[model samples]
Target: MMKFKVLFLLTIIGLVTCSVNAQRGVRIGYIDTEYILQNVPEYKEASSQLDKKVQQWKTEIETKLNAIEQKKKELDNESVLLTKELYDERYEDITFEEAEVLDYQQKRFGPEGDLMIQKRQLIEPIQDQIFAAVQEIAETKSYDFVFDKSADVVMLYSAERYDMSEQVLRTITRTSKRSQAKSKKERQELEDEEVVPVVSADKDERQQALEDRKASREEQLAAKREEREKAAEERKQAQQDLRDAKKKEAEERRQKVIDERNARSGSTSNEAKTVESDSTAKAKSIVKADSVKVQGTVKKDSVNSKMPKTAAEIAAEERAQKLKDREARQKELEARKQKIIDQRKKAREERERQVKKNDSIAKAKKNEDNN
Candidate 1:
């Protein structure tokens, strides 16, 4: 009884395992981070402001670099005329000035460059807060996995249905607002850190205009070169392809002519055979007719010799016999001519049919060969 109970327990466990396996399945979702970042007003405002700030910093760095380069050029130009002592003194001065410039630049825009880094740092936490909310949503909704929709890896997806970015953005915006409202000191610190000495507004504008002009000229030159190269390559390829196509067409035409000549030759040979047979038949008939005439002439001569009669009677008999011989020869010639004409006609018709059949066969073979 104990063994039977154990076996029943094992069976119950197996059934339960199968039921659990059937019920278990994963739910997955996707989110478009870029869409969320762009559509959310707070994120849009922050991103635009950050871009402007970064551009300003980049322009300032460019101006500084240009100034340094110009100064170096000036030093090089002066070095040729100066005495060693004077040159050394001037070089020391320039070196000191460069060191000062570098120190100031590093202090202002080093690892702790401007308030932008701080702003990004602050904003990153807010993004993390949104990520946390997304995680919570996934867990609560029984989702096993969630993927970022803006990523390159997610090439195709259900557009509207897969996007949870809007909800995530809203959560982030609310969190950021509440966090800012709670921390006045941090906001003031951010504000204070944003103040930095920058180039004069007019000079900055003039420099930017110069840079834009230079960039535009470079772009135009590069584009013209690219266009010229592309046009040349296309022309070369087109000429090559034209040559290849012409060669192929010429080959096909030559093959077709060869096939047509073969068909004509075969038809001509068949017609020649028919004509030869008809000629032989007509020649045999002529020989048979000539033999019969010879026999009749011999028989007539013998009869004339055996039976002597009046001259008028003999003349009338000869005339009648000559007329009969003439009629017989004419009938034999007519029958031979008719037979030759009929044979010629049948040969012509057969040749025509054979030519047509050969042409059709040749065409089919040509098509098969081409394929």
Candidate 2:
């Protein structure tokens, strides 16, 4: 009967253990202390103030050192004229000044110095607040263990789902707001303020947030790409329009030149001038012969081809010949322009070389004179 009772007691204990195990499971989370510190405005302000102090101390030290350096330079320059006793006194003064500056630097910034002390003083309260926030979050979220990711404890691999840094920052913000409230009305207002709900370590929620951020980034990229494409298209259209306008202007100029040539030919037609004096006609013949000789050198084949063609055909042939001559003249002009540019480039290079040679000669002579 005693054995049976003992077995019943052991079975009851085992059942209670199984019930407890089923009721609870370990839920671990961690906060990044460095991230928390960066988000805390009070800590940031304190750090900025400390940095200013450090800068001021560094400037002071630099000024003293510069003064010492200037004194040493002056002492070296005047050493030949100075008495031994006076030189020793100035040297001692500079040495002592340097030592003082170094000591001041150490006092302000050394390991056991004011800088470290002020940093600890500024950060301790912030750390306490963080600890309280972390504790509150852990308790409220039913977290079995909460670790500091930025602490000395090494975390080789940590999942993003377990990060609670944002919650800690929110808690800090709320606490600060509550502390700043000076009246019941302000407290009520702060309490009524719409705050973002703290996200727990739910995989679905974290995944959704990540996806939202990714979608937002992609949208921004798409907007920027669309803007770029629009700008590029505008630039391309503007360039094409400019090219078309230039081509139209060139065609107009060519047509105007052809019309002027046709008008001149008609005015100087054989059917019009039948009343010129003999000498004037002779002079005209002389000028015409000279011009024909010049034209013969350029055009081996004459436009006055002896093919019994119609007036319209002759005019078309002449116009075509004129166009070819104009194009040849343009080519010759471009070649001359290129030749002139090359000559100028060569002349410039020669001038530069001559100037360098003269400078070298002058430098050599000056050095010889100095020696």
The number of the candidate with the highest lDDT is 2
lDDT of each: 0.70, 0.78
Against the true structure, whose TM-score is highest?
A: 2
Please report the TM-score between candidate 2 and the true structure: 0.48
Q: Which ten residues in a row have the lowest lDDT in candidate 1?
A: 193-202
RMSD of model 1, in Å?
A: 23.0
Report the Cα lDDT for residue 90, model 2: 90
lDDT digits (tens) for residues 1-371 of candidate 1 = 99999999999999998886456545556777767666667667776887787678667766776777787788789888888998888778778777777776775578776664756764676567668868866755555678876677645537464466766775566555556754787666554543333333356447879999999999999999999999999999998797678657866876786688668767865776686677657766765776676566657767776776767556766765775686677667767866776786687678667867876786677567545
Candidate 1 Cα outliers beyond 4 Å, as residue runs = 1-39, 121-125, 128-166, 173-371
Whole-model lDDT for model 2 versus the true structure?
0.78
Q: For each candidate, give its TM-score against the true structure.
A: 0.39, 0.48
Alpha-carbon RMSD of each model: 23.0, 27.0
- Candidate 2: regions farther than 4 A off: 1-23, 188-371
Model 2, range 1-371, lDDT digits (tens) per residue?
Answer: 99999999999999999887556556888999999999899999989999998999889889888989999999999999999999999999989989988898899989998999999999999999899988887777778899999899899999997899998898888889999989999888777752444544565556878999999999999999999999999999998797677657755765675577556645643223332234346545655664565576335334546545677665655765665675566556556655765675576567657756765686577557535
Query: How many clashing pairs per prediction, in order?
Result: 0, 0
